[model samples]
Target: MSNNHGFARIYEQGDQVNYGRSNVANEERHHTRNAEGYRPKDQNKAMNQMLEENIQDDVAERYKHDPTYRATMHGNEPSKGAKIDAEIQREEEELLRRKQEKTDSLPGKKQ
Candidate 1:
């Protein structure tokens, strides 16, 4: 229910009966004709700041306790994934080194 008066009111005050109160129920839409599109920003600034602080604190607390969340935030892959990548890169380099040695061992004066 809207508590604002004059142009500030968004909903009209009224009374209704539920199924328990009566057999028939009534419904009405409360859209104020003079309601403005914008509201004062300072009205909820303190409340919003507090909520944001609480959320940041919660995230910080979770970062200390949640391994999965920390890993996800740091990178999209696990530590084991990095190790696997390193192994694959090492294998590739070793293969290239062997190929170079074989090429060096080959005896050819002209192509």
Candidate 2:
């Protein structure tokens, strides 16, 4: 076998030697962007931002002061009794609303 600089193979018996240099590339671009440890400093600001868009500003402020309501809002503190009470209250309110809507929809109720 002729030992040519380009044509000559490095390994004598095994598969052809494929050589390319690998460097330690910086992984900064592959990192996930997120708020690692960010939390709102102001309680009111945090609450307002987390609240639903349809939630009234005054009602959200009032809810902030209620301990039971707050506990139920966040899952941190469990309130089984409060949850049951809320469910019952919601059903009652929903029934009342449906009744009012049905009454209003009637032709003789109000024009």
Candidate 3:
């Protein structure tokens, strides 16, 4: 029968039909349904802490292996904190310049 064939087709394609809608269903099944709408405080804390630890370890490893990074960290070769401060100042100035350029590129701005 035609109706029987349609039901069989639906049964065969059920998994594919539900695949695209499974993410929200999976999240609802796995996560707590919080009505308060507030984010879980410690949800991202562990990830952020792990990332920070990894970054520190990488920086330490770089300082050990790379001469330029060692100099920046230890303030050994380029006159201590002055070089670091100058580098930060230069970066800030560069960022400001880029921002100004973006603003200038916008329409209806009188140069």
Q: Say which candidate scores most in TM-score.
A: 2
Question: CA RMSD for every model?
Answer: 21.9, 22.5, 20.2
TM-score of each: 0.32, 0.36, 0.31
Q: Which stretches of candidate 3 lie over 4 Å from their true place?
A: 1-39, 74-111
When 2 and 3 are scored with TM-score, the better candidate is: 2
Better of 1 and 2 by lDDT: 2
- lDDT to native, each model: 0.46, 0.46, 0.51
Clashes in predicted model 1: 0
Error of 2 at 28 (Å): 46
- Which model scores highest in lDDT? 3
Model 1, 4-107: lDDT tens per residue?
A: 43222212354221122111111111222211222333223323333445577888997765545656777676577655665776788899999988888788
1 or 2, greater by TM-score: 2
Candidate 2 residue 36 Cα shift, in angstroms, is 38
